[model samples]
Target: MNNNNFLKPLLFVGPHIILFIVFILIPSVYGIYASFTNWNLIGDPVWVGLDNYKTILTDTDSTFYSQFFNGLKNTLLFVVFSVPLLIIIPLLIAVALEHKDLKFTSLFQTLLYIPGLISISAAALVWSLIFNKQLGVANNLFGSEAVWQTTQPYAWIIILIITIWAGIGGNMIIYRAGINGVSKDLYESAEIDGAGPVRKFFSITLPSIRFPLIYTMVMTTAGAFNVFAQPLMMTDGGPRQSTTVLMMYIRDLAFSHGESIAGLASAMAVLLGLVILVISAFQYYVMNRNAA
Candidate 1:
């Protein structure tokens, strides 16, 4: 009986464990190894020790150096702009939908969540037309003559708009679930104590959903760092590559025309991963300490 109980649980989780090890763990280990070597994805990887990292980090006159810094700067800008909106808008929507007087909550949730299910490529195409300079609805409606794709801040604005639109649903669902799990008795007690909506939210709801807040914030920041599609399709990292993100640079280096700079790409990827790890760890520490 004891063996059967153990076997049954393993049966349920074993496949996932195998898949994670095979796909995620093995690839991650190999990628880290590859970052130390020169690889073109076809020939045998030539061990170059820290050459790739040194060039990317210290070779200020190199094109790789310029690309790395610019890409990282743009990526950080995206995270700064998008992460807060992604968290706050979803949380606000989730809170609004939690109102007792709200009708058709399920319908609203479905409508919001459906966008997230759509592919980023398709969403970008749709948004591109909406922001098209000659015949776009944006110009037609607003009576402005700005070319959204080629303009400075307008280029960034559309990327953020699409990102937030597709992203809002998933985090909102998480917040809604977190909000739903809070005990109703707590709200009633707050009401009895003459707590207003904002007060109750800060005191009761926020504290109750602390884990979800931490989760969404961390995940959203990580996702924002890896952003590639919106800028790729919407503006093609245009207006002098002002919107080019780190992932775009990484992809270009790894698989661009002619020789692939796999080693450099892997180094960039590893660096980006370290940045994410440090930030996520800091966020976890701060949020966990506050919760405690």
Candidate 2:
């Protein structure tokens, strides 16, 4: 009977266990192993220990070295630029819509939420046209001469515009859900204590949503690190490759023209994964400690 009980639980979870091993577990292990070797797709992998890492980290004159640093720098730039806006805008909007006097909130929520559901490629295409120098609404309305895609600051702005538009909806929904869970009694009591809206928000609303804030902060930071499509589709990583992120470099190394540099690419990928793990751990530790 004890064995039967254990077997039942295993049976329920067996499919998921098998999938994790086959798809995620095995591939991750292989990719790590591959990072220590010199491999082209058709040739057998030759073990090179830390050579790939050495080249990427220390060989400053090499193309791989330049690409690695440049890619990482751009990825960090995107994360720094996008993550704060992604968190703050949604939070502000969610709080505003939750006000007692606000009406048709569901209608407003649906409108905000719809953009997150749109495909990135399709959204990027629309945005590209909207920023077009010759016929775009933005240019005509503002009487600007600069081509948004090719111009400095303007190029980055357009990318941020689309990213914020598509991303704000999801975080706003999360904030709304968290906001709804806070006790109404707390607000009423604070109101009786002569607390104004701002004081009540700081004392009640923000503290109540601590977990959701931490969760969204971590997830959004991770997502920002993996930003590829927005820059790829909007700027094609141009304006002199200023927007070429780490993923773009990884993709190009592994699958672009000529022989694939699978091993070196794997090394860069592993390094990126480590950077993310460390940053995420630090964020969680700091935020979770503060919450406690």
Candidate 3:
């Protein structure tokens, strides 16, 4: 390759590089620096060094601890319920579509993917109406009067339903791509060996798509941690703050509260980042160990 080939690629990518540096890297570094100080919007940051962290962990009256714990709990619960369904349901649909005998596979794939393309805010708004006690079709169909958000477990159920509805389609497409990439020769070989569809899936199809499965799992975990828009739009952190997530809490701290502890919000963001990093690392280790 000539020297100009390298220069041309750099020219194409240079704008993105500059934008990333300006928008992401600079802000991230500044946020980290701000985390160790006491700064609101107007005043000069006073170096408080660990005081914000101390307040988050120890201040009972502040409700910071409660919010953090509640958010953590809800996020974990959402992950636990949604992740498996996200994987399994999509995988099953992909497998069904992979069959040559299936009719209108292209049409089915398009219909399934339509939901993923819809704006999350729009989807959440529609579901919010669906879960509304007085006007919702769900209440009307069931002849029930329970307030979905005010009720304990039902509130969570509503959140889960909306989450699954919006999320499953993207994963399904990924899985379908993975399934399509598997060579027909492998299936023929399995057939010659008297292996059934179930056997072929477990032994051949699943192993062929291990990388996609791992990628999806990691993305899902990170997405769960950063879940803000759905709960924020659908529940507003809730009738009892049942749907409040960590990101929403951080936003509330940084902007909504007049005290506006930019430092505390930064700390929370950093801590959440650390949690995601640790979980991802652990997952990678376990996967590699199992492969080995």
Give TM-scores for every candidate, taking all chains together and pairing residue i with residue i: 0.94, 0.97, 0.91
Across residues 94-213, which tens digit of lDDT does each residue of candidate 1 receive? 999999889999999999999999999999999999999888899999898999999989999999999999999989989999999999999999999999999999999999999999
lDDT of 2 by residue, 153-234 (tens): 8888899999999999988989999999999999999999999989988989999999999999999999999899999999
For residues 195-249, write the lDDT of model 3, one tens digit per residue: 9999999999988998888888888877877888777777677868877888988
Candidate 3's TM-score = 0.91
CA deviation > 4 Å runs, candidate 3: 1-13
Comparing 1 with 3 on lDDT, the higher-scoring candidate is 1
Name the best candidate (by TM-score): 2
RMSD of each: 2.2, 1.2, 2.5
Candidate with best lDDT? 1
Q: How close is candidate 1 to the true structure, as a TM-score?
A: 0.94
Q: Give the TM-score of candidate 2.
A: 0.97
Whole-model lDDT values for every prediction: 0.95, 0.94, 0.84
Which candidate order results from sorting by lDDT in descending order?
A: 1, 2, 3
Which whole-number lDDT from 0 to 100 does residue 265 have in model 1?
96
